[model samples]
Target: MSVIRTAILGYGRSGSTLHAGPIEKNKSFHVTAVCDVDATARQKAVARFGCRPYDDYRRMLKEEPLDLVVIVTRSDQHCQMTCDCLAGGVNVLVTKPWAVNAGEAQRMVSTAKSSGKLLLPWLPARWGSDLQRLRQLVVEEQAIGTVFLVRRVEGSFATRNDWQTERRYGGGYLLNWGPHIVDPPIQLLGSPVKSVYGRLKQTINPGDVEDLFMGILTLANGILVQVEYTVSTESPPTWFLQGTRGTIVVHGTQLKMNARTPAQPSDPTQYSTMQAVPDKMLEEKLAGSLYGDEHQIYKEIAAALCGETRYPVTPASALELSRVLDAIRTSSNENRVVMM
Candidate 1:
């Protein structure tokens, strides 16, 4: 069998639970190494994968001839790690906050372009059936005329209190969770942001970064998106969309999408909603979520990079997210609308 040698650069919780297991299961990709800064974590990663361990990413890329390097480390290290791997002649698939700001995203994008290496964001959220259906619905000229509003809420009691509390670490409610929630809206809207107004409140985190954040985005195409999120919430989770036709609301991981999009008579629009439910809900790309059959994500990504199919997590999409995030932070700090 032809398998791409893949290295996972972090073996933390998200890395272990979400990424490694799934990717290893793909059969098309071999888990060549698992990396982390802590010696104990490295030992465990090595034990788990029966692969070598490296304290430094630079060392890993230098010693191992890899087909792909998946970055699951902190925000500060993401860009440098990505650049290093690309410069080392390896393809990269890294976690979000692709950079600290839009400028960083641009540089990374430029590097990927020049090196001819694939750089895609780790937004598996886009891999779901519901979002793809929504994207398809928008493209097919559905009742959701023009996609006027995309309102999303990324709720978690664990996130804000955990790694998201510190701004210096690129920690915050938005930075931690906003990427997944905001991806669909931006993709559906397909409009470059024109301006943004933001509101930030430090609800739980004792650090400089925000805890609960909300932003109003005005796209160049005149689409408006509202991103509402918090790190502390026990309420029923919700992620939703609205257009001229109707709405689609997915409550949680049950593939439970309650949709009301622009009306479609005799077309069984609800079937589209029902069809949008993902057969699986994977928390990370390298691991299986709920059950088996978890190889599609990397298979699709590798295929897309090799010009066989389309990979949903494009660098352009990552750039768009960063741009919106930059505008939001600027608007919140300057106390005025900022143009993107």
Candidate 2:
């Protein structure tokens, strides 16, 4: 297959670690160009990949043609960058927390549609074996029974006081990390959120954004997905599904099955967090168990762009998830349930 020459708009952590690494490794795409206002980042991308670098994406797009542009900048920059890229007749793949609000996301979709360009904020975890296969089992196999409740928790050590503390730049835990933890429930429940009651706390860390958040979502499926987020937490994290038959618990990066058939000591580690860390030596065996599932995410995006698949994050789904976040903020303010 011929390579898809790509341009990356930002050389931040997402660009360097997430997008650059995979795109560099894959044969289907080659990162031909990069742009970053940060001199160090630009020099690194230029030197490391032997590609052209620019301080402004506008100038870069004007000078060099690219098939795709990866927007790995701050969340606040997504709408304009996407608009500019699409208007310049280039496709875009963006980092998640699609937009700071629903209106911007809708506008992005509309602009892309008008320009005949594709814009996707693909959350990679939804394609994992643990998530995808579990989605199949839940709806297909009726595994984990009825699934009365779904709970997702993302806890990390924020003691270092990273930048996710401000309200501007979409600097909050919700925008920084919520999309990955929340996508699975939306996929499994197959429901539109009808109402939301939520709460947030900032017990350990002091900042404009809440270090902890909890939201109760009443869905059209008659199931509830309770989302909890905390960066100040010290406990081991879990993403759990409870049902009539049994339960499925995703602890850290391990998956445990409890059902009528029960489980042996082994069943392949299909937990979603396996590929997040770049430790080649620590868990090679478990990583190998999840071989084909590695970049099911990029495959989903590539398929959609190649016209073989649809946008994985639909407009309504994006709106629903945004409403959930909105409700979390509203409920934190009004101290009441918010209608969707």
Candidate 3:
């Protein structure tokens, strides 16, 4: 098998640590070059990876022979950079928010389709251990019968004066932490969102954009998923799964579950307002690490590049996420539920 030569754009934030670190750990990928405008970051990249560094991304694209380009720049730059890379005959693995809106995401997707290049979104949450376990229980084993509601809550009491708090730079909790928070429930629900009702506020951040948001997604299967990402003082359970027979809650690394036995009606005419029937309710406590295999996504990317298999995260799915995000914004702005 031949190693896939790769280049990275942006080194300050996720470019080096998130993109380069994983690529370097995977044997199928080779970091051929790195592009960053920061002189110090470029020097650090050379020292760490021993790869040539360029200040200009286009110059690096022109000079280097690369199979893949990982774009980890500001959210606003994702669309254009991805299109440029696809046009240059290199597959793109861009981090979310892949685009600020669904229209931009469509352009990126269309460009990749026209160029015959792979466009993958960096959605690591799909491979998270908690979600994988949930899938096994809810979908395969039917441990939790008929999932109806799923909730993901993540946030802290804090304020940042960084670029992330500003709208012009494509910075907000909605774009920053929203993708990771939203992907798992969507995958588990296995349905396209039918409508979105969202509320965004600028609570503590100094930016013009909202620092926190509460987004309610009603899926096609009628499963309701609520996502609350805030910078406020309240910290809730990380995850909540409610089904017909059971409920699951995750607090830190611990998962607690309670499954009630199915109650059978003995008589056709007897309708009791309340009756306690004990059929031995199942209770479980799962305690341990709640992290997925870190390099699984990179391994899959290598396989996809080798034509051995298709990348699991499809362009259409990523675009759907973008569309959901767009609807959330619309709902928040207009103060009404937006239909898909």
Of 2 and 3, the candidate ahead on TM-score is 3
RMSD of 1: 7.5
Question: TM-scores of the models, in the given order?
Answer: 0.82, 0.84, 0.93
What is the lDDT, from 0 to 100, of the residue 159 in candidate 1? 35
Q: What ranges in model 3 sit over 4 Å off?
A: 265-291
User: lDDT score, residue 157, model 3?
Assistant: 88
Ranking by lDDT: 3, 2, 1
* Error of model 1, residue 65, in angstroms: 1.2
Q: Local error of candidate 3 at 261, Å?
A: 2.3
Which pairs clash inside model 2? none
Candidate 3 lDDT for residue 172 = 87
Error of 1 at 217 (Å): 1.1
lDDT of each: 0.72, 0.74, 0.85
User: Once superposed on the true structure, which residue ranges of model 2 sit more than 4 Å away at CA?
Assistant: 231-237, 260-294
What's the distance in Å from true for residue 212, model 2?
1.2
Quick one: best lDDT, which candidate? 3
